[model samples]
Target chain A: MALIKDQQLSCSHAATPEMRFTDWVSGGSDAGDAVLANGADDLPSLLAQAGKLSMIAIEFDTFADGRGFSMARMLRRQGYAGEIRAVGDVAMDRIDFMQRVGFNAFELRDDQDALQALQKIGEVSVHFQPSADGKGPAYMV
Target chain B: MYAYNEFDQTLIDQRVEQYRDQTRRYLAGEIPEEEFRVLRLMNGLYIQRLAPMLRVAIPYGLMKSDQLRMLAQISRTYDKGYGHFTTRQNMQFNWPTLESVPDILADLAKVQMHAIQTSGACIRNTTTDPFAGVSADEIEDTRPWCELIRQWSTLHPEFAYLPRKFKIAVSGSSSDRAASQVHDIGLHLYRNEVGDMGFEVLVGGGLGRTPVIGKTLRKFLEPQELLTYLDAVLRVYNLNGRRDNKYKARIKILVNALGVDAFGAMVEAEWQLIKGQELRLPEAEIERVKGFFKAPDYLSAMHASRDLNDTFAEHPQFAAWYKQNTRDHKQAGYRIIIVALKNQLQAPGDVNHQQMDGIAALADEFSFSELRSTHDQNLVLADVAQRDLFALWLKLQDLGLARANVGTLTDMINCPGLDFCSLANAETLILSRQVNETFDDMDYLYDLGEIQLKISGCINACGHHHVGHIGILGVEKGGKQVYQFTLGGSASNDASLGKTLGRSIEQDQVVVVIGQILDVYVEQRQTDETFLQVIRRVGFAPFKERVYGTHQRSAA
Candidate 1:
């Protein structure tokens, strides 16, 4: 499956092994390489493993529910430098906003063209807000 | 009044094109309806009951005359020759087709307007007092701060897809004309004892099935920390607000769930990390924006005030209109004329294309080529000279815009209910007409002074009925529309939610009940007591007794 990383469409890149947040935090489960968390998951539990985890995949179950964007932003602010991958219903319209709020890697849906979705990240270059992308807002600039 | 710079212009221009593409994709079957609904909503296009309603933002309710002309032109070209001004101080074309919305937006872009964030689940238009800069008893001018918020929240990446819609309002006046208390974030701009400007921020207030008055989140916030603090609050809401139920998903529910103190603490912690850093508004930028809102130059002609008084004696209708529709401006020679959209006209807030063009022309000639739309669904021609008021009133009378009912009983805030909106349970425009017809006597209306009657077709409270002194909410029961009345609410500085009266009146009995309620107020009131003061003085008992205390009362 294709994954968009650093604004480039990597056609043959395979996803890292990951586990659900419940499985990772469950009493007797293996230390998965990556943890899959939804918007409702508490960050304190995930921040403890922020150092050891190779990646944390935040499920974008619905674009309308914006908890994923907040989780991604909070993940960056809490010093999680690992790959933050977006999965589930990741459409082109939300891709640019996802990147601005700190989604670096995306697992594009099968029907979406990886290249076209990659081009969506910079659709509107002018920025009004300084978000998790580390770019300054134009007004402040 | 802040003119769009290159960045602002470029962003809006690109946004128009982007919306055009989205429309193209949606119409061409490249995007599904489920996905297109969200996109169209974010662009302020609602696939409503009758047709697509296009709500265009007035950017804190301030519009240039040319922009009003553009709206008139669009109404004539695309809509059904009229537009409805909403309580958010925005205008909505009720009959635009889905395909024509992009072209309408393109037309709006030529005049520095867009519908972005007007109806989305994101931050809607930041509204302030309609008499913002020109009012007599205002704190500081709130337009500059509103412009700052307007720009900062435009396409804000983090806030674009909130759990539900977020509304922010600011009031810098002693009287809260903006209805700041019922907003998600109500910024009460104030000056401290040390003479520095700060904000008293209120959070979590909203009106729907569940109504709440916002609680104070921060007692004092610095000017520079405005955007940052707002960011912290939004981030907190976006992260922790409920997603399980649609009805319980507003930020108000989250604030009440986790107490206001807890919400404030979390916001403080998040705000401390980014408060003075990223979104800190620069002093130069604030000053630059403030420069745009400087009061217009007053004409230096020193005409004797006695001449206008003599002219008023000659025309009693003009005198009544001058007294009712005009307000004292901060400038000595200037006055603020409220063009009432609540005549026995078509509907409460609907202005025809010809009236829109006429008002635009009047604004260009009398006022300073500027107009302000009030949240109560009226337009303001703010900078008219006091001497020109009689002439202006005559012209307004010709256009049927001078209803001479500024704050009287007929000046009601009514929602376009079941006829247009699928969310409504009953019709409101016709009810509004009935009320106007029942209270047609101007002298009697003048006697019943300053009554805020707000009505909504459903519990969504689009008409802001919760805060009205006399609020009416419609509901469907036994397949019939019945409207319940709430009493003693105020959306002013002293904000309070009204208490619901005893029983729901049938559709035809609303006007009669209103008449009986006003009669009770008149009977019990002191010499100078208004309807609300009488309600507060005697409590809701009298109004209840007048309506549902006994069947011996008037029958519906």
Candidate 2:
């Protein structure tokens, strides 16, 4: 239930409250509900609604399931600059990589310590490749 | 060897700490075992049947003397004083404790090595020809590109969690020693008509339950476009590859389903968007990485000596070892010696700490303080002067490494099957020993010429049995070990999967079956024709008839 933004504890602010991925995709009556996308949701259709959404949260069904990372990256590449939050099975070890792939806000699993996870976000000082962070690859740097 | 810069070192150190935290959390019951499994596997720790197995990555099979010594030290300190070399050009320590794996990775980090992506459903250690730079047949040195890909794939954020484990191999030689055809992404470096270096990008080739040869996605990808193209290929696989069924998750299955042309088009569409992005390899970075793999300063006057020939003349055993175990190097008077780890007495690719230390010393004295691990589960001293061949052979002989069967049938690539691996359905080491004993004569093996005999305890094909000239797969039926044999497969320039000869046979009959097959080859062979060439010429019918006899074929 904790939200972390830019490696610090943050409060959730959104135009539309949490909506299930299925309800968001079913063309529901609620037009302004900030949607939650499943890891397996179709990206192009999701991106089509990017302009209307205030925020979009992606669910990692399992921590080992990495389809969400690619989904987040695809969302970012498609020019969705809204708050992209990651929820479910989120742990401290995966924060740095998740951040690199464009997950700005993390709704970690209930067990993870929000403060401890913050320290882990910047623990890895260098990354070998360029990512959503827009920092050049370490080699170019 | 490619020396790690400060950035590379920092990343590894951070990774070690991260894994340490994960371990502590998992041990503290904060992280569940199922979630922690992938985390540990990404760091190259696998909980095995007997103990925790740690796979240490050796990028492109290159290692320095100090690094090899560090591995020996780790084996002595952490495991049972030995390590196993794998067909993917990595090392495995089979006796590590689950609690101590993070500490082992820290130790590896001190020597600029890490097990990053050595296993798991991620891009693995990028392997290349062991004789990469020193091979006379090489069009270009491939280690630099392997290093680039290694860095690109290391902790890659988006592609980390794929449907299945992915493997990539590179080769710059006309001869396909790296087995490029059987990898998820195979990069074959070559010069175009105008002398521009590029790669023929092969996609979706792999060995497993559904083995398929990689198809060429791009006929030639420019050198600068390698990473971007690779990124596109991986992205396509990650998003579109099947995740519903674990068995059908590998890119090979997707490539077959989508068809190579459609897959290539998808990758092309993706690449067209990211082609000139930051992932492009800058000229300076390419040159900087290439600098690490430059040729060593070989003595100008080094040449084959008359005294060495005289010594060889006196010692017939040394002569046999030199002729069979050594390969011609590009540099004059230099030879690449394959330190055979497949001696009949020792387990395939298992080297004791003592042997490791001795090999390190040998590398320092004879091979410019550098060594390589071949995909054949053997080590190589790639820059030995021809005049030092006698001395090197004698030293290797002292260590029981001079098997003189480098390319022979006895030098088989085998997996640590049911003996160590939890996934293996049957035993591999026993069958390996039986086959070794049945074909122990070096003279006969030499006459038989080059043959690749590979065995796997399961269909996962870690031993690459699918691509072996004589492939043997172990299966458990009715609580008994049964083996299936195939013939005519290869991992060379003309890579092909072997066809099954017939029905599975009992374990006790494996040796006799192989013997019968070789007998057929010997009976029908022309002069200088190898076992593979003979099989290709006569087809599998002749060998199958002899091995199974006429009655067994109709036994429905």
Candidate 3:
């Protein structure tokens, strides 16, 4: 139940490698540190620092914003094995899609029911394409 | 026809259970009325002004004999023993109770069919040329591609809540019987310069208050990139399509807002990011879907025998039917036969349980056990041998399925209108009956030749009046039904929206107006010129002056 402000993660607040797991990762932690960003361009650097990352969150400004899904998929493809959580305007309908694209955790508002959100993940019985879960064949499979 | 695989079957089964739960919740007051309304519409159940109507998708309008029989059985048990074939190649049952819809869906699921996305804002039942596999002029059969789109678009999570409904049509034949240009997305299959089969994609074409022909967005989209390109298009529309005003909310408005070049550029930009990605259809997958649509083992029969020609010459009814209802099949000695649903007394597109069973049986016996529903609301037996047509005709006559009015005036495309549709502003079935009664001569109709009479109950154009040769639109004036006429529309290769002829007339004057137009055509037409040709040649002036001259004088 973590809250993510819209523009907290910036180049100025970059997290350093020395930062420990318990430290706050948002703006107030420190400035001029190597903080994590969630855009497609940030995937390579984030994968390079995968072990020290306590948490990685991607922003979905709208419910139907799917670029974040691809960014998460790229993270998984580049072997960033960390807690990738989706933040911002995510709803019950988008949980399964986020999961399919390799978001291990989600941060929703406290009023939202987590159980119903979890049920949405179980809606699709099969996936036509392979993704971060390392399941399903490539196109041929 | 593409038979459903296990995955398809399971998904529909799950959908039925899901809808059943939703229905139970709605009836039990667990969900509020407004919330339940969206839920029911998503499941293709509409609580109309009268009773509940359920539209079942007939995927590209192709059906196995067993599926048709199941529909007939459902009609007898759950409905009023009849179903209406819709303009989008689906069937609507007008009398199913809300409580019984889940059972009806369950029955549909059992036959590898469901009512999913048929009436929703999401991608609806994908329609293609009714004669896809059998048409002689086809570059490639478009059924597999339609089936692929059907799978990809069913209950697609992101596109489920669009501003308005979306329709996609594909045409493989040169004649464009699917009316591709008038759809939200119209795909015309053609061969590129290097002999590669692909689609010329058109977007933003629709018929309603504003009817615009879809402009070509892609010159050639290869077979595999079809879905990914469509994904790009739908995603663009979902994200940016107008949502504020229902009138300007269709994807057409968005396409018109952004000129075709800018819209195509946006779609191309989106597609460029995902073109060769997972959504790109793999070669194996294309073959996997295409394998299901391989042509039936047609009997290697050659010429129509002297006996068939002799029979035609002997019987004028048979001759007229042969000229009209029958079409050339790809294989030699085979004929594609249309079982016209346009009987004189019955409403257009109405096929009862008995007729459905008869068609199913006939399809099983003569048509490779398959049937097709045309965009024109006629049933086709796609692979009947020419020698067997006489035998098929006798069996069809016994079942009353052999009306032999495929392209005649009686073969009108009339909407349910005020009769069953809640959206209808005026009564179309009454007007249709008047037209049918007035033009009862088969010989005269055969001479008139290939006239399309499309009637819409309202401006919604559900009956496809915009593309009809003689479009009749029913409007309401002073709380009574009035009919307006449009001339020179055609849905074929030379597709054009109809031009409105003068004033709206009372319901009783519909037949007289139609008669006067036909009289004008007879007087002005060159030899063998059809109604549409005559109207196009004369530009509706003579007919307009003849029908409305006195009215103009009175008004003056």
Candidate 4:
């Protein structure tokens, strides 16, 4: 699997064990990163501990399941500065969109090339919606 | 029409390149067909029954003459020598090759157009009144707001892959000419009691497998915060809408599942958080978009409209065309000409390349080089001079574009159906022709008056069968195509769904049933009462009895 960070190929440093939302609510033994599923309804509880977490790897069960996109946006809007990684079914075609909606790192699916995905993420230099850092919407820019 | 700025042009250019790369990859087997399906649909390329159908956005149904010419050129070069106008006010080339779609999009980009988000699970082209700026009864022109929403929805990062396709429509006037009540999100422009112009927002209304009229989310949404409010609504749908069931994934289903009150609260909570953020429209941007839609300079070109009497005196046919195919414009001397594209020579809304060029030339000579397409599947010269009506009518007649059938029963909105669409259960274009030929008498159609006969090949409702005054749905029972008839629905200020009359009828006999219903209306109508008025007054017993008389005659 290719890991993309800062618009380039990067080694996977996120080897820490992550806490699933279900496990955390059920009182898991260990806590590291937060693994938030797209369908998880306990985002408010996760937000309460968002500051302490180093990463929130949002799960995408399928490439077409777009709940992760909105989840990333809400996480960023709530001022979570930690890395938001997209895992599972992530591909090069949607890399640019993931970045625009506040995904800082992408754990690409097995088939996609890290180098090609990087080029695609930087392709369409303008976006219509504002990024998490409020960079665009193309009109004001 | 909102002119494309340099930024807008760049985005479209880049998009063409992006879609080109995606198409190339898919063709090269680098991208699988399953994944490519989503990508191509996002670009409006649908793998149809015959060939790949390409749907190009006509932003809020407005197009410049050059753009119309470019569409004509594309249809000639890549597709068949014709293009079809859709109920959503877009253009469709029914026979485009998948390999050559990128080239077509590139050509569209040259004319400041694209097929971005016309299909797929994303926010689509936001439509409004074709007579937006020129309509006399509108509170104001809604094209600017449509443009604003278009920009906001274009390549929207989060919404690119929603659970289902999302559609939004704006109504400039309270009369709902844009069919706002049957959209995913309907924005009604109105002045509140305080005299501040805002919007009454409706969510979850759609015409599909389960047709539901939209429910109100907010009584009034402040103008500047339109984008923010929309973001909230889309976010709520994206977050909570069903992903498991494809049929129930539309926002309408989610609205019903959560109930409108709970759904509205969720959207309201999200809006409270993002209310005045970057999405807040600056007064300058709103005014800047408005400036692009301002009235053309030929405001008082009272050139020879007074000679209209002379034209009337000369040709009775021209007088009939003038009375039926044109409407009063906000500008006194100007008129909005509904170039009758719904005639016998072609299918409903189909325009050959020559007809497109003819309409473009007519617009250039008479209507300030601007044109508009309506949801009714007709073209409009929104600012034609009254004096030019006769000349325009003559030119349109020569091109076979004048039918004097606008708003009449023969001017039907028919989907491509099983002829092209893969999702269709039956064919509709030929059925539409059969009905047209059966009701070819113009005087009878005119006497019937303002009847919307919409047909759908399936329950997907692309033809908006739910809202037609006379809705016809084609379903296959026992491998035989049969049709169900509905009565008394409308897509106007008075919005309602048509009710089923009796049972399904066979294809050959569908025309007989329709004729009997129309005959019933004519037989039972009071003076000047429309089909809807007669149905509302007398209920469906008369229609049911006549439509089922043959079936029940032998059975009962």
Candidate 5:
């Protein structure tokens, strides 16, 4: 398994138990607790708790299931300042795009390579379109 | 064609290596079959019945002569010595090995081409009117906008895996040759009263088991807001489009279920947040993209050629070919020549290596060194001089490409079918040949003017059968191939889906039934009325009764 943060290899954070959005909301857990949301989670409800959560790790059931990217963009737009990580199915080739859509951390599948994923981010220096990263397109740059 | 700068080149090159590594892992069994299938499909590689098929994108169907030659060379060296042009304005090689696909992509990258996003559940190649820049009816050249969308959608992270395959088309001409109404998102470029170009956006149109014409989402959108609005629409679809059932997963179903008004509201709301963000295209970049599509040079003094008309007067064969296979160009001295690939016995779009080479040479000599692949499985020399039409026709005849079947009954839009496609339910090549032979006479075909006969092996509608004037869908019934007929469909400005006839018939009866239907049209038509107009005027009752009524039933 590989962990990449801010386009580089990073040390793992201290372990925190992941709780569902329903459990975190109904159970009256601490506001700053870590929470996990799948692609199917309600985005408005998640955004309601974005400021309180320390980290929101959106899980991808399958790599091809791209609803998570939308969810991540919504969270970022809704003022989620804490770490927003992508969990599961994080292949190396998908890392750059994941980063573009406001994924600060990626927890790749067990078989993926971290160094390769880190290097992949630098392969393309400029992209034609802008994303949640707020970096303008290459032409504007 | 847009030249690839270093950024574009590097990204494509990186994608080649990335796919290469993925192919290596998949072949090594490190990646499972199910997992690698999506990856390969995103790169336009499909596992077909006979061998692996690779669909290379010809962006908006524009290609230089060298690029055409490169495609012919690839077909010669990698697979069989032929490539099939597709109804989506792309090319497919049906006999390549899975192991060699990356090497093929590497070669394509050398020529600024790749197969990325040609297939799979993603935004596909953005097609446009083949006569984008050269048509007399054009309001704005749509190819530059298509190229913009192409760059934005290629390898887009948020849309790589949508509910199902997505198609976008742009039509700049009033004629609607790109079939924009039958795409996932259709953009019609036009000038408002003030003469500033904008787009009429349509969403949720598609052809499949459930064929539908797209609905207008926005009456008019400014040119600079294309990508932002598209992003908003895609974001809405990504989050809400059905993923449980692949059959009902296209954006059309979602749009239908939600209602167009509600869908438009959602996209409008989403657009409010990202409207003026970084995705808004700058004026400079728009001009930069537009600069790539500047008009080619033409001779100033060569208006309507008297010599050409004289030659046409002397030779009726040349006159017939000219009338059927040529279109009016925007430029005074230029003409767009349709190079028909549907020769008598050949597959609809199958071009052998020699034909490809011949096409390249002809393009270099007469058509500004550029050629276009049309949505109807034909090639276009978009910038031919009117005076050179005779020479061009002669050269095309030598290559066996002067079939004079553009928009005729024999110029059918057909899929590769079960002969090559693993997804097909029945074979279609023999049926194509049978139908062509039955309607072979040029005089007879010209009399039956402007018939769009499309055939698909299944309901996937890769052949676009649903929009064909006489649509034929081949299905497997009780382990036997059956062909069903449909009527009154058209993919033009008046876009409508074909309604199914009574029932399917055996494969052998397909040609006979078509003949009977044509017989009815011949017997009960006003002078110079098209088959579609006659059907619209009289309805399908007369034709259906003739086919399914007592007289034809007894023969069956």
Candidate 6:
């Protein structure tokens, strides 16, 4: 069980590297690397060293603080090909919003069940507009 | 008075089906709760702390008597026999179940009304001068243009998902009754020196957390190119508006960051590409909308009759009401009567099922069977006969809708605050009651004269406190309600933002504080100086000194 801290993580977390899920995918490390890759200085260098990183972690200090959501979108639009994992204060209420902006996995807070959060994320049946993941079929033109 | 065409009808009908489908899917457990929350809000359905509230749009505050009766029937059938008219000139029913909403939409559709774009980050209703067609001073009737914009923006594909909710208001009158300066887009219609009618377009004005006066983007946009230019402005905002922070997402912030000149240039550049394109209003279409709003055949009787003067002398109350609520009409022997919804006891804009029916009946009797909902929450019977004034007054008095406080202090503009609104931080209705009770003396209110008191429950400024002559903002401090007051705001031709008078006071102290402020005004004011003029001349210093002085003395 991943212990998702709700406080905003330091800038060093964005620079950390992780094990590659697929060689074809080239981006920063997954969000899980924040805990796995310890210390501040090594994170950015590790992110630079990865030839095909597939995921990255970002923290939301509070449920209302939406800075992390923007950070994830900026990373995706800047051509970072990776899974953006949302950690910290990521609840079921915010899952659809996070997914719309391009977050793939949400590490739930300690008190909340991850399985329930995942189920909640899968339950969205309709979307009005295209998201960071891709444009909707209706908007493909 | 602009009638919906087939295209407009079809669009609303389609939107109803869309909402119905979404509701069905939610109930069937296909869409998750959180996702459905956003979807339902977009459809103007809010699950309040108590029950489901449905907000129905009263576009540009114009409604036929039939429409008003339909609302009354809907309230009786679907809701709790009452509907609350909102600050935005819309109406909200507090107790509609989720299951009954589709039925409500169906009912509203029967009367050519729907709640589409009433909520969500879309182009909301295009509000305008309530006295649009009937105002003696109007440059042109703006209802046709408002109706055109309504059709154009309803479920518009490209601009649906903007950074924030957008509002546009237009004024045909030089007095600025529509509060055009405080809207997302404020358009003042005028005929230039060459006798060609155009709009003086103002953009980026809003009243929420960061209240701003809209800047003039176009000094003169030709009537035909209005929609295209508006589209260009919206496109610029849609693509570049900050979506990350909801607080900084309004077009005002974007316009401010870019500077007005650069923003106007960008809009002009975009307009150059699309000006002669598909969005331009066709001559036939413009005429078709205008045909519905042509002035009715009014009798050419000049001056008041002996009967009217006799009635005035016989009835002082009726005379006072006439003096305050009635306005000069363009046609001789005709007047525009405002039915004041700002009565003392009831919520500012709440018209009961019976009152709604009565108003509908009254509209049928006078005013060419048309009624308008002003932004200040009053209903206007815009073509009253001079001979029928006394009779109309008597009937209106019977229904408790004949308050003479048209633009007076007691004619307060307030939101449904904590009593019905979930977003409210404090109870605005109670504060309104307190203020009303404290200033119940009609003579005192008349003495003060034409002061606009606007209160908002929260920082969203739905009650338009930023533009009030005396603005009271309800803030929550440590789980308790506190009232903050601002002075010198005006939403008329000379629009200005209110300045904070002093520190926040407790809820109970609001009425007394307001009284003290009024006391200061009375003491310092010169003869015939209005509340706004006095505030402008003497400044907030005297009022602040009095209010704070009383506070310190009480503390000691």
Candidate scoring better on lDDT of 1 and 3: 1
Error of 4 at B90 (Å): 0.5
Cα lDDT tens digits, model 4, A1-141, are 778976778885664235676675567523455555555557777767667667888888889999888888888988988888888889999989999899988888888878888989857777677887576864555
Off by over 4 Å in 1: A25-32, B301-306, B549-556
Cα shift from native, residue B299, model 2 (Å): 0.8
What lDDT does each candidate get? 0.87, 0.88, 0.79, 0.87, 0.88, 0.78
Best by TM-score: 4
Query: How much lDDT does candidate 6 score?
Result: 0.78
lDDT of 5: 0.88
Error of 5 at B444 (Å): 0.4
What candidate 2 gets wrong by more than 4 Å, as runs, is A15-33, B301-307, B550-556
Instruction: Show the colliding residue pairs in model 5.
Output: none
Scored by lDDT, model 3 comes in at 0.79
Docking class of 5: medium
Tens digit per residue, CA lDDT, model 1, B398-452: 9998888899878899999999998999888878989988889999999888999
Query: What would the TM-score be for candidate 4 when compared with the true structure?
Result: 0.98
Question: What DockQ does candidate 4 score?
Answer: 0.78
Cα DockQ of the candidate 1 complex: 0.71
TM-score of each: 0.96, 0.97, 0.87, 0.98, 0.97, 0.80
- For model 5, residues A13-78, the per-residue Cα lDDT tens digits are 734347887788888857778888887887778877788888888888888888988888888877
Cα misplacement distance, residue B470 of candidate 2 (Å)? 0.7
Worst lDDT window (10 residues) for model 3 chain B?
A: B298-307
Query: Which ranking of candidates, highest DockQ first?
Result: 4, 1, 2, 5, 3, 6
- Pick out the ten consecutive residues of candidate 5 chain B with the lowest summed lDDT: B300-309
Candidate number of the best DockQ = 4
- Cα lDDT for residue B110, candidate 6: 83
How is the predicted docking of candidate 6 categorized under the CAPRI scheme?
Answer: incorrect
List runs of model 4 lying over 4 Å from the truth.
Answer: A16-18, A28-32, A138-141, B299-304
Give candidate 5's error at residue A121 in angstroms: 3.4
